[model samples]
Target: MTSTSARVGGIRKEVDAQKLGPALLIASSLVLAIRTARWPATSDEGLANVEWQKEVEHSGHIAKAMLSHLISRYPSLFLLKDVPWYVPTDEDVPE
Candidate 1:
């Protein structure tokens, strides 16, 4: 009986760990959308800025992380060879 309960508890923990990351990711995204929905959607510049910020936030994080990893492995390619690293849909460097 104790072994059966332990096995169930272990499975429960594994399932919880696997689910928690995605659950947190989705929850945070929903919370962000709810909070930012208050912004005025009228002006052209304001809307554009919001879109741009979203792009920068999402793309920039992914791009920078990838670039940093590549740089770590192949420093010569970036530093000495002058290879231009490009990120997807990245027009300009994020500030």
Candidate 2:
């Protein structure tokens, strides 16, 4: 009986641990969604769009231009080298 109780307790702990990950992921996504929805569009966002258009017009890819912009704006987060360019849509501009 004692071993059965211990086994049940261990299973409960494992289930709780597995639940923790998805719960945290859902919570984080909710927070991010709320924050992004609440964020006001800035002039920089528009500027970035114009810059992107110009770059794409001048060349084929806006990767270099975006890299420069990211370097200037968010240097810490910027990965200038070997960065994966995954634009969501052709009309989707950087902010």
Candidate 3:
């Protein structure tokens, strides 16, 4: 019984860690955007007033990083290696 409880506790810790990963990513992205925005503009800073400078670029990078992290960490989120794209479901069958 102790072993079973210990196993379940381990699984719970792993699940909690997985949930924390995305939260950390979002918090870090916000910190990065704020830090970059607070930097003083230089004389050669081009298009200082442009909307794109307002964290949009950082958001794009963050999105890509998040996607890469998720794909690497949870490859099973995709189809099996040998599964065909044209595999039919119940909806595809004639009623």
Candidate 4:
């Protein structure tokens, strides 16, 4: 009984250790990303993105622009949502 309990405790500790590393890494990365976004560099593209983010924020169009950026980044995102070239008929899926 003692040996089994000890092994189980060790396994639990190992899993907990694994979780801690990933959580720490993700938190640190998010912090760095926010800092970089809040203070963009002098590069033209970086400055442009920063300005766009600012303008969207000020104009209250942030959601629309953010959505557009996401869609543009993945041109094929709406491919699956698009209607087929051929018109659908009752034969396609009988009611």
Winning candidate number (lDDT): 3
**Per-residue lDDT of 18-54 in model 1, one digit per residue for the tens?**
3334444554465556656776666575445766478
Compute the lDDT of residue 16 as modeled in candidate 4: 27
lDDT of 1 at 42: 61
Q: Provide TM-scores for the models.
A: 0.32, 0.26, 0.30, 0.26
Q: What's the count of clashing pairs in each model shown?
A: 0, 0, 0, 0
The whole-model lDDT of each prediction reads 0.46, 0.42, 0.54, 0.43
Question: Tens-digit lDDT track for model 3 on 1-95?
Answer: 11222111121112233445565577557756676786666665565655546565666577667756875798555333332234344555587
Error of 2 at 34 (Å): 1.0
Candidate 2 all-Cα RMSD: 21.6
Q: On a 0 to 1 TM-score scale, where does candidate 1 land against the true structure?
A: 0.32
Which residue runs does candidate 2 get wrong by more than 4 Å?
Answer: 1-15, 40-95
Error of 2 at 24 (Å): 0.6
Worst 10 residues of 3 by lDDT: 4-13
Q: Write the per-residue lDDT of candidate 2 for residues 1-95, one digit (tens) a residue.
A: 11222111121111222333444455445544554575566667444566435533444223335444655676555222332334244234355
